[model samples]
Target: MIDFNKEVDRLGTYCTQWDYVEDRFGKKNLLPFTISDMDLEYPDEVAQVLQQRLDHRVLGYSRWKHDDFRNSIKNWYSKRFNCNIDSEWIYYSPSVMYSISKLIEIFSKDGDGVLLNTPAYNAFYDVLRTNNRKVIKSPLKNENGHYSIDFEDFKEKCKESKLFILCNPHNPTGRVWTEEELIKMINICKEYDVKIISDDIHMDIVYGSRMTPILKVAEDYLDSIYICTSPSKSFNIPALTGSYVIIPEAKTRDRFENIVRYRDFVNSPAILSVLATMTCYNDCEYWIEELLNHLENNLKYTISYLEEYLPQLKLKMPQGCYFAWIDFSELNIPGEQFQKMLIDIGEVAIMNGHVYGEECEFYLRLNVACSRDKLIDGLDRLKKTIDYIKL
Candidate 1:
């Protein structure tokens, strides 16, 4: 079993989450919690496999044997979610969002309506806007601490848009949508003929069993919907190879592929990274399960600690992913102010919520996928800083 309590030093690992904090956050040494990457190393077994592949020393162009890649991907979804995925329906892309941009080109036209839930992964907004598509914002309603979809508003907005870019197990808020929720969401999009482009990057690492895929929840075979997924976030293999784009509809899939003809984005990583990602899916199953349990423990402990000692700062432990959407509105500070205060004063780095949407002015996202001791230390620093400033 993977050791959940183990800590790997990432301070100078040339990481966006760790190494980039100084230039990005304007602090010489910031206590960073802003980025989505985990501060832990990949499993030793996985590392060994990659190192073995690296021993060949010649890094050159790679090709997909097709079947080998398909089996690894199909097996992951079938084993994890019990959803049947046809390998024929899968396409290759370097990054999930890169494909999302390509889908915007395929499914949507300039001046066409594109809808997004507010408080998304910032990149979603950037991609849509870069393509000159009109972005429609449908903000989720905050219920207590966790946020839920406003179905009524979602339906109305979907009616007006031709495409919807959805974030499953949603970013910033961390809502692991249930099957019922996914269907209701899809049905509404279907009614308006909106193509559902779901970003299922965070499909794994869920803390609860209630969450399922948008396709499973979607009643009937809604060919218009697109499932863009990757194992990058799931296994911490973003620097590795590619992502999967599953489109059940032949016509739509053809259109997506046609969009790719004008550009050259089918860049697969080194054969080593590809093999490593596939290996993680086929063999690292046990490690993922153990990691989820440990992360859930961290989320629960952090929430309880905040409630008992730092009541002014509100945090809702999510049902999926390693993110915690924290509300600091009670502290009467702006999101950036709180983020800077956390770094400058509390010595803890965290995400500023404003970039997600205007509605996130008082929220910040924190990653709890660290060693238990690091998480505890970060929490204690946050508590003292927030409380000390409260007076």
Candidate 2:
């Protein structure tokens, strides 16, 4: 068993979460529970594979269109999700966002409506705005901390949208889209003839539920659905910089490949990234199981701690991912001042939720994918912030 409680120092490593807290929070040495990446170390097997590759001492261009790379992904889907993935459907990209950005550019003109749920992954907003696509927001209905889709609002927005981006096992809120949810969404997009891009990057880190891939439910609507996913979040290797998109339509796949190869000139995956993917998917299943258990324990601790001390702060145990979305609206604190206090008085660097969407201004996203000691310390700091506000 992996000792997840063992703390590994990440300071001075140029780490975004640890080393650069001041950039976003305007305070150095604040305890940070921001950033999606984990503070925990990646699976040892990934490091082993990378080291073995480096020992060969020949870092050359590497193609990802081979049996080993494709089969690893195919086998992972089959074994983990009981879903069959065709070898032809898998295509490599540098990152999930890159694939999404390119797909938006390819399918939609500038100013065309691109629909997504509000309080989304902030980077989605960045990508859409950078490409000059109009963001069509469908606000999720949150009832007593449980979030659900407003299908009526979603369908109405679909009519105006050229593309719909789905975040399966969604970030921040951590709602694992059920198979029923996926089918409903797929049918809506199909009815409107809107292209779908499902970002299932958090598939492997689920709790108490199975992650239904968009392709699983959109089998009939395969031509319009694209799945952009990677092992980066599950394995905590974003720095390696590799991700992929699963496109079922032949013509669309060819067009995307053209842009990736000739237009963008990004033909090969990073040697270390592909090796890490293969190693993690093929040999690190045990590590993932342990990681999930650790995260679940952390979630339980967070829920209990909040209920005991900071009961006014509302939170629901996430269905998946390692983030706890806590509602601070009950405290009646203005979003901007509350954020400032968290930094100045509490000396904690939790993410300001307004950045995700205007509706999220009263919320804060806390990262729980750390050692229990760090989690306890972060929670104490959060409690300190709340106590100070009450004074």
Q: TM-score for all predictions?
A: 0.94, 0.99
Evaluate all candidate structures by whole-model CA lDDT and list the values in order.
0.80, 0.92
- In terms of TM-score, how similar is model 2 to the real structure? 0.99
lDDT, candidate 2, 1-391, per-residue tens: 8998999899999999999999998889999999899988999898888899999999999899999999999999999998887999999999999999999988999999999997799999999999999999999999998989999999999999999999988887999988888899989998999999989999999998678887887778988988999999999999999998998889888999999998999878898999999999999999999999999999999999999999998889999989999998999989999999889888999998998999999999999999999999988988898898777
Measured on C-alpha atoms, candidate 1 has an lDDT of 0.80
Clashing pairs in 2: none
Compose the digit string of candidate 1's lDDT tens values, residues 321-360. 7987888888887677677778778887877788799888
Enumerate clash totals for all models, in the order shown. 2, 0
**lDDT (C-alpha) at residue 39 in model 2:** 88
Q: Give all candidate RMSDs, comma-separated.
A: 1.8, 0.9
